[model samples]
Target: MRAFVLLCLLLPAFGQYEEMWGDKDYLWDTPGFTTTKPKHKACLYEKESCGCCLMKKQTHRMEAFFNLTHREMKKDLMLTKMYIDDMRASRSAFSFALDKNDSTECLGPFSDDAGIVFRHEFLNLGNNYNPMTGIFVAPRAGVYSFSYTISSDMKRAACAHLQVNGEIVSEIHGQDGQDSVDSDSVVKAIKLKAEDRVDVILPKGCIICSDKKFSNTFTGFLLYATV
Candidate 1:
C-alpha cells in the first residue's frame, strides 16, 4: 500500500515537467525564446539605417536650395550695380539766360574784356556752369551743342562772341535802326575735353541789351561722352 501511494506522487511531477516544455516553437520554450531576441535586434538595426538615409536626403535638398538662392541674389545685385553706374556716368548739361532789365548791358571797352556774366540759371546739370563767374567748365570729355541769343534795344546795336578756352567758336550780332527791337542767335557743336572753359564775351565797343523776358540766353548739352 505504501508503494502504490509513492508511485502516484511521482507520476504527477513528471506530467507537469512535460507540459511546461513540450513544443520547441512555444514562448515558454528556452531555445525558441533566445531566437526571438536576435530577430528583434535585426529589426532595430534596419529601422536605424532607414532613418539615417532619410536624414541625408533632407540635408542634400536643403543645401541645393540654398545654393540656388545665393546665385539668384548675386545676379540681381550685379544688375543693380550696373544700372547705378550707367546713371552716374551720363550727367552733363547746362542752360542759362540773361535775367536783368532791357536797359542792362554787358558793355566792354576796357583793356581786359573777360565776358558777360549771365546770372540766371534755368538748368545746370552736373553743376558745372557758374553764374557768378560767367564760365561753364566741362565736367567730362564729350561732344557738346551750345546755343546763344542776343537782343538789341531800339536805336542800338549789339554783338557777342561765344568763346571756348579763350577762342571764339561762334558769334551773334543785332542792330536796330527802326523803332522795333532786333535780335540774333547762333548754335554750334564742338568737342571738348574735361575742365575746358566756355563763355560769351562782348568785344570792345560792343553792347548787349536784355529785358525781364530773358530774350538773351545761353544753353549747352552733352551729346555723348567721348571718354
Candidate 2:
C-alpha cells in the first residue's frame, strides 16, 4: 500500500531498515529547529546614533544659562563705574591758593565713609592753621548737605565750622572775603546714616579747590545714597 507507507517511515522504533542508512555521515550539516518567534532588532533613533546623546544634553543647559548671565552683568557695570567717577570729580574747575605762614592738613579719621579734603595755602592767611578737617562716615541714614570754608584775599574772610558726632551741625563766623562762592558757607539740608560723622572746619583761610571736587576732596565727603 505505497510500499507499506514507505516501510513505516524507514522503520526504527527499535528496529532498522539498513540501520537508518547507518548514520549517513551524522545527517551532514544539521540545523533545524523552528517554532516561529524571534524577530525584534529595532534601535535606530536616527540622526547618527541615538541623536548624538540628545544634542549633548541640550548644549549643557545652554551653557549654564550663559554663565550666570555673565556674572550679574559684571557686577552691575562696576557699580556704575564708581558712580561716574564721583560725578567727574565734582564738576571740575581747578583752583588752589594759600601761603603766608603756609599750613595744610586734612583729617577724616573717625573711620570715614565718604570724605573729601582740598587744602592749598598761598601764604598763611592768619596762620593759626586749621584749614580743613573732616570726618564723615554716614552714607545711609538720611539728610546730608554739609559745607565749609575760610578764605582771605584780604577783604573779610575767616571762621568756618561744622560737626556731626560732636553736634554743632553748622557755623560760619568771620564772613565775606576772597569769595570763590561761599556767601554763607555751604552746609545745606543735612541728614545721614550708615556710620554718621561729618565735620568740616576751616578756622579762617579761604579754602580753595576746584577741578569740580571729589577726588576724595581731602576728606570733606561725598557719595550720598542708599537708604
Candidate 3:
C-alpha cells in the first residue's frame, strides 16, 4: 500500500511537468516550425484551415506572377508591330504637270524611284472630241480626296468633266463666250486600292487664251492621295 501511494504521487508530478513543458516550448517547436502567430499575418486560420494554407499561398503567388508577365509581353508585341507598319508606309509626295491635249495614263507596276510618267491606258482622252485632258493614278493604297478648278481669262466657252474609272464623276462648265473660273468643288472621299485610276476630261472649248499653249484648255485639276 505504501508503494502504491508513492507511485500515484510520482505520476501526478510527471503530468504537471508535461503540461507546463507543452505550454512553454513543445507547442511552438513540436512541428519543426514555430507555431506562434506572426503579428502582421492575417487570420489565415480563420479563412483557411492550417492543412491547406501552404498550397493556397503557393497557388496565389504563381497566378500573380503569370498575370504580370503576360501583360508586359502583350505591350511589347503591340509596340513591335506598330514600328513595322510605320516603316512600311515610308512614302514621298509626288507631283507632275498636265498638258492641254495630253492624256496621262496608268499602266502597271508603279515605281517609287522617282521620275514617274504614267503610261496611257486609253486613247479617248486624247481624242479630237476632247481637246483638253489631265489624269493621275494612285501611287499607293490609301484614303484620297480631290479638288478641281477650271479657269479662263479669255472670252470663250468651255466645259470640264472629272472622271474616275471611266465614269463622269464631276463637271463644271462655262458656255456662250463666258470668261470665268469654275466654282471649286471636292470629290467625295475615296478609299482607293493601289493603282486605281482618275482622269479629267474637257471638251474642245474648255479654256481660251491667245497664247496657243493656254488656248481652249483645262487647268488646275489636281489629284492626290494620302501616301
Q: Where's the lowest-lDDT run of ten residues in candidate 3?
A: 107-116
TM-score to native of every candidate shown: 0.63, 0.26, 0.39
- Cα RMSD to native, each candidate? 22.4, 24.7, 19.4
> What pairs collide in candidate 3?
207-216, 207-217
Candidates sorted by TM-score, descending order?
1, 3, 2
For 1-227, candidate 3 gives per-residue lDDT tens digits of 45435544554434533432333221223445545566445334223343244333333444555676799999999999997775444331222223334332221122321111212222222121122334555556666555444444444443456666667677766664443432233344566666666655554434422222323222222134344
RMSD of 1: 22.4
Q: lDDT of each model, Cα atoms only?
A: 0.72, 0.41, 0.42
Order candidates by lDDT, high to low: 1, 3, 2
Q: Per-residue lDDT of 105-192 in model 2, one digit per residue for the tens?
A: 3222233233234345332221222346334455345444444544333344444466667666666554555453333444355665
Summarize candidate 1's per-residue lDDT along 1-227 as a digit string, tens digits: 45435544554434434443343322333432444345544422343344343333333444555677799999999999998887676687888887766455544444655588888889988888899988999888889999888776655666789999999998766664754666788999999998999999877666667778888888998888887
Most accurate candidate by lDDT: 1
lDDT at residue 14 of model 3 (Cα atoms): 47
